[model samples]
Target: MRDLLAITKAIADESRLRAVGLLDGRELCLCQIVEVLGLAPSTVSRHMAILGQARLVESRKQGRWAYFRLTEDDAPAEVHDALAMVLASLKRDKQAKADQKTLKAVLKIEPEELCRRQSDCKC
Candidate 1:
């Protein structure tokens, strides 16, 4: 029950949902997600942490970088079902479409470059 509640709460936010959408299948470095969402690294990290606690996503550390991907193979049935529902529901959303487009461009930038750009931002 606690896990179920956490999963629902984790996905309640728009930004977190979008992050989940971006991570639907592929693994992405922290910087890539940061760039796609245009959010501070700390903010995105917090979002990912919530998703992690829900067992909706998993993270790995490689050197100084962290990468995240959907928790497919071992995710509980509820988490899997919730992910499917969210993905299907957002497939045609306007903001999701824009995020997808931006993600394409964000992916083109090397992870290091993305991290550098993010660190240099004054906003």
Candidate 2:
């Protein structure tokens, strides 16, 4: 029960919540999350830690890149329902809406520049 409450508390922050919503289904690299969350890699990493401890998200490491994705493990059924409702309603959120705008803007970079800019820091 303590762990459950702690996990929920960790994800309870609006920023962390937004981060989860951003990567709900899609796998996302740290750089992309940085671009979307507008938060530093360190901060994002902490969010991921809490989320992972809660079993709400999973991480994948490939070479220098680490991708994060939503998971369906260990959470109460309510968490799943909450996530589903959030995903369905999330599109209407101002933060998510703004995040999409930023991502689209980022897509215009050249290949080398994108790689350099994207860097795949695996945050």
Candidate 3:
């Protein structure tokens, strides 16, 4: 029950949902997520933390960069089910399609350059 509650809450917001959608099949640097969501790094960090707590995602730090990906098959059944539902629902969403396009552009930029650009932001 607690796990279910956490998963539901983690995905309740639009930003978080889009974050999950963005992570469907690939790992992403924190900066990539920030660029796609157009949210502050701190904000996206918090959102990813919540998703992590729900076991809906996994993360690791490589050097100074943080990367996040959807949980794998070894995750608990509840998590797998939740992820399947979320991904299926997002499949036809207009915003999710737009995000995919934006993510493509973001991915074209090198991760280091992306981080540097983000650091240069006034926000």
Candidate 4:
């Protein structure tokens, strides 16, 4: 019951759901997701945390960067089904389409460059 509740709560928000959609089949660095969603890095981190708790996403830290991807292959059936539902329902959503378009450009920028740009850093 707790797992179900967490999964439902994790995907309850539009931002989180969109984040999941963006991660359907690709791994993304935190900065890339921040760029696509136009949200603060901290905010996106919180969203990722929730999704992680729900077993909907997985993360790996390499140095200072964190990469996230949708949980698959080993995720519970419910998690997979929920994600499928989200992807199917939002396939034609205007916002989702816009995000994907923006994501193409976002993906072109290397992760380190994206982080530097986000932080307005010269390094």
List clash counts for every candidate, in order.
0, 0, 0, 0
lDDT of each: 0.88, 0.69, 0.92, 0.88
TM-score of each: 0.94, 0.75, 0.94, 0.93
Q: Which ten residues in a row have the lowest lDDT in candidate 4?
A: 114-123
- Top lDDT prediction, candidate number: 3
Scored by lDDT, model 3 comes in at 0.92
> Across residues 23-71, which tens digit of lDDT does each residue of candidate 4 receive?
9789999999999988888889999999999999999988888999999
Off-target runs (Cα >4 Å) in candidate 1 are 120-123
Query: RMSD in angstroms, all models?
Result: 2.5, 3.3, 2.2, 2.2
Off by over 4 Å in 3: 120-123
Q: In model 2, what is the error at residue 118, expressed in angstroms?
A: 7.7
Candidate 2, residue 5: the lDDT equals 75
Q: How well does candidate 3 score on lDDT at residue 51?
A: 96
lDDT of 1 by residue, 1-123 (tens): 987999999989999999999997799998988898889999999999999999999999888889999997788899999889989988978888888899999888888888778874322
Model 2 agreement with the true structure over 68-112: per-residue lDDT tens digits: 888766677756765676667778898888876776676454333
Give the best candidate by TM-score.
3
Which runs of model 2 end up more than 4 angstroms from their true locations? 73-78, 105-115, 118-123
- lDDT string, candidate 3, 16-68, tens digits: 99999999889999999999999888889999999999999999988888999
Question: Which wins on lDDT, candidate 2 or candidate 4?
Answer: 4
